[model samples]
Target chain A: MTPASSAKAPFQNKLLPLMLLLPQLLITLVFFYWPSVQAVQQSLYIEDPFGLSSEFAGLANFTALFKDARYVDAFLRSLFFSAAVAGISLSLSLLLAVCADRVVRGATAYKTLLLLPYAIAPALAGITWMFVVHPSIGIVGRAFIAMGIEWNYLLNGNQAMGLVIFAAAWKQISYNFIFFLAGLQSIPQSLMEAAAIDGAGPAKRFRDIVFPLLSPTAFFLLVVNIVYAFFETFGVIHAVTSGGPSKSTEILVYKVYSDGVVGLDIGGSAAQSVILMVIVIALTFVQFRYVERKVHY
Target chain B: MRSFIAALSLGTVLSVSALAAPVEIQWWHAMTGANNDRVNQIVEAFNASQADYKVVATFKSTDYTELMNQTIAAYRAGTAPHITQIFEVGTATMMSAKGAVKPVFELMAEAGEKFDPKSFLPAITGYYSTADGKMLSMPFNSSTAIFYYNKDVFAKAGLDPEKAPKTWPEAFDAAKKIRASGHPCGLTTAWVTWTQMENFSAWHNIPYGTKSNGFGGFDTEFKFNNPTVIKHFETLNDLQKDGTFKYGGRTTQPEGLFVSGECAMIATSSGFLGNLMRNAKFNFATAMLPYYPDVAGAPQNSIIGGATLWVMGGKKADEYKGVAKFFTHLSKLDVQVTNHQQTGFLPVTIAAYEETKKSGFYEKNPGRETPILQLQNKAPTENSMGVRFGNLPKIRDLIMDEVEAAFAGKISVKQAMDNAVANGNEELRRFERTAKN
Candidate 1:
């Protein structure tokens, strides 16, 4: 909710901005607050999946989560997954954005091809990756096995985790690339010309001039990618690992889905979702408070 | 012209009424592919048999858990289908949900439909019955876990094509011999916990959990950490160490291994027979599940694994009547026999089974009789009845997770079973707490 106080979009009538903002505010209230309140209400009770019975046990659900080692493990695993996905996608997208920025011909084709994966659903992306890496039937999987590496992701926790991470990051990279490319293009050509006149190499120009300018976009993407990896990648995990091979790829969101939707542990699932919201809120807050200090205008 | 116009209007009115329009009974099932076709065939047969009722079947989902979730949601919303296929895992959940379902026995009785509980096979129907032996759900496509191996691979390994390994030790020894004969994997199983753990416990007459495998009460605890189950896992672990046994993830993924002939043997559901008939290019055969010979009262009857038709609670009285008629039609010996033969699901009624047997179906289709024979091998004991606990899908997943850890050598067999029991008991306790009814 940006203020209408900015002179660029100032209104003669003071209430006009509020009138325009009503629709969005109403949407936020109905969609966001309603479900959140329901989750909080549900987290307090041991409710039946079929809604047949319910028992109120204040804070018991939250306490049970703390006592469960698997929940703790899942929390740590999600933290690692979010960090890995954010870091990999941001860095790779930045590199691709730089290369694409330098392209004089077929720029639209390259950009379109790179962005194509973003349009693919997370579940489809996961399935496509599975088709390429299935140990028995996949092309790369067969090659890996032929090279004497055991390639079964089904039995190996680490391999399963790797597959999910790759699928998730692969799908996310295009969004980051689009933003980075925009940021790159927006940097004035005079700055690069000035750097070239000062005898800066291409590498030096990028490191010293380009990267600092793109820091704001990178920081924005960092938050988006972290949130995406933490919450939105459940489909990828479901399609590929399904939190299996000893729950190696079982992130917090996936656990919530499994417990709530699949396992019918309504109270536990609500408690987990509540915790997930808290974690992401705290994470975004910490990032804006500290990490944002490094971002340029 | 006026008379002609009046006659035309009458003809239109008559066609619109369509002879009192058959009552539409909605059936939601998790069947897909060939099984989906079989479901439609049954519906078509039922619709054609009578004008009073027309059963319309909807493919809810291929995954039973998702279908149950949908059914629960639909029931809560008051938009539930009249009849939903509840898999064996959801039986305890369905039983516990007092008002969520209209028990088939009660429905039949209320509708004045002739339902002889004795007509159904004891082993198949017993799992869906109450302590007083009152049938709760109508058993439709119940299947039991049985052993299967490629007889071609057996011949190649210099073993008898007709004789599948009957004992656990002999099975492992045969696997070792098959490995020595140059196959990369000798055995793999689908529905890992179902074949190796749940039914294994039942087949060996070992307790899977207390209180008759959660049949008696909600206070039951898992007893799968016993020596019989642990020893079985230990043998699997050793086999894995030597590359004789390959772990094929969870349910039905290892089916591919068996079908592709990558793994020579598999222990999975009798329901897999249809898939095997279509996909398997080799000469495959079935046998009773392997048992530990040293255990007392070993090789007891195995348990059923498919699904039953649950009459969901809250529908019109006439709708219930239609459901009753459909159930009666389904239980007819001809329909049941055709279903059993076509889909490899065990016939629910003994009459249907006897009819199939009398037709010399077994002589022509060798592996088809294995599931029925195994289920009726003996009177089901408390140990051999079947496992039934609320939130069973979660419990099974927990057990499979532990078992996978054991397969990976990350944990010992005993530790895995112990973890599974402890975790399973906690889940059971959670179920007990949340579902007071």
Candidate 2:
């Protein structure tokens, strides 16, 4: 939260900067803050789906939300989902970035190929993975069955969770890789060579010099990936499992849409959205508060 | 000089017609594939028959639950189409939204359009009508649960291909035999809650709820966790133990398994006939949905599926007239018969059924009469009319979840039924609160 140290020679006129930042400020207020305020206000009322009429319920919506065990289950499921997505995507992307950073031949092609999945839509990514592992016709699913192993995601909750996690992380790996690769390449070459000259092995140098310098980018990516898993993975879940087979894959965000929009429970859906907004805000706050302290930058 | 003179006259005629364009009525529907083409064809027919009004059909159907949700959203935004098709599961939601919809009975009466409530087959219209007998929506495409058995598979399994199972126990026995014959799948069902729970209760002449399955009021409770339903689930769960039955997920997902010549038998929407005719490689025939022969007054009429065209509120008066006229045109015997014969949707009217029968359509197309026969096998009792519950989509998910848990051996069939009732009742309670004031 500290102001950038490099801004010592900042602009003298506050009015110029304020004018420059006005558009973004307005956009955030209208797009983010307005709907957020409405969600909070709507959550306080018992309302029908069509927004035709409403009654003041005064926290009844929140009470009803927590009284249902499924909402709590969805919360825990979301936590596990977000943590796994961020962890797996981060480590895999870091490994790939390191390998690509060391590439001397056609580095651009390697990087381009690695980044291809990032551009694909999340729903399309879910569908592509779905067909590849579909129990009946999918290639991977057929192999599982051929090997005498059970492989139906539509019936099995654990398999459905695993498939969605892999698909969601698979799409996110490339986004993380670009940042990790940039972090690696930005490290001065002299720092690594100096460590080697001091009898440090490559692994030792990476552990000592490269990782610490890359911590800032890694920290930022972790926060972004968690947010991505929380709010933006609705398309993937919708096209794939649809919170199916007994609400096994019902994450908190998907529940909001399923409840409010599909199920026509407007008050409950709004209440869920309010809770999600609080969780995300608290999550980002924690990431900046604690995680930022360790970043070398 | 002759070509220029002819072109000038053509331009003048086109300009004159363009100045007097018809008033457009927007219709949003979810019909897809072959059904989508049929919907457009019907709209074109309506438009061709009128000079002042043109019905424009837009395929705005989203996911199963989304169409109702989208209609509500559009209503709030004041951009709802003049008419939108809603699934039967959402009939309760639409019925309670008095401010959001214009009832078909009122629309027809106000527009002076010739609409007869008695003209529609009661089994289909009963699902969309009020307790005092007012039709809420136009019954466009209606379907009921029907059983399909692969004749080739039945013969291969050493069963009499001509004699399909007429009871639940017999159907299960036949399914197991198909599995014993090394078929990949034996039996499967689509829309499990619809086929097994809603229609199953109706077909058994059992009360699925207290207030005539919510048709009486919005405060109906769930009563499906009885011994009868539990026994049915037990049979299904046992079938899954040896792969005699495959849980084909939800809503037409089983259609692929059945049509791919894999599954021997399936209980799915009669609307699936179109798909079976197109994609089924094996010989298959339709039968009345199997019922428990032990239950007294069993084999009651099956409830309808498919969707109805609802007129949204807030359109101009002239557009309302167009929607009314369109509904009248759509309910014509010929149009209804074409829809029934082509798409396998049940003809909504008694006239259409009699006409189709009189034309020897059933003789030409064997097995096409199974759905109608099942729907009219007996006088529909209170329980057999239809079931409605608010937030039925959510309740269906809960039921599917528990049913899956039972099928996956995470719980007993008794426990699954218990949880389904408990959870489903909770949704009904939430809806009760929403519906009252």
- Which pairs in model 1 have colliding backbones? none
RMSD of each: 4.3, 5.4
| lDDT (Cα, 0-100) at B270 in candidate 1 | 87
Candidates in order, TM-scores: namely 0.92, 0.93
- Cα shift from native, residue B401, model 1 (Å): 1.7
- lDDT of candidate 2 over A1-297, digit per residue (tens): 237844773776779899999999999999999999988998898877776678999999999889889899999999999998899999999999999999999999999999999999999999999989988778999999999989888889999999899999999999999999999999999998999999999899989999999988988898899999999899899888998777888999999987887677777889999998988898789888867576655
Q: How would you encode candidate 1's per-residue C-alpha lDDT over B1-437 as one tens digit per residue?
A: 99999999999899878888888999999887767889999999889888888898999898888888899889978999999988998888898888888998999999999998889887877789887788899987788899999999999999998888998788888899899999988988889888888898888898999999998988899999998789888988889876799887788888888898988988998888888988999998888898888898887899988888899987999999999988888888888888877776778889888888899988998888888888888899998878889889988889988998988878999999999999999999988987777
Candidate 2: where are CA atoms >4 Å away?
A1-26, A287-294, B1-22
Quote the B-chain TM-score, candidate 2.
0.93
lDDT of each: 0.88, 0.89
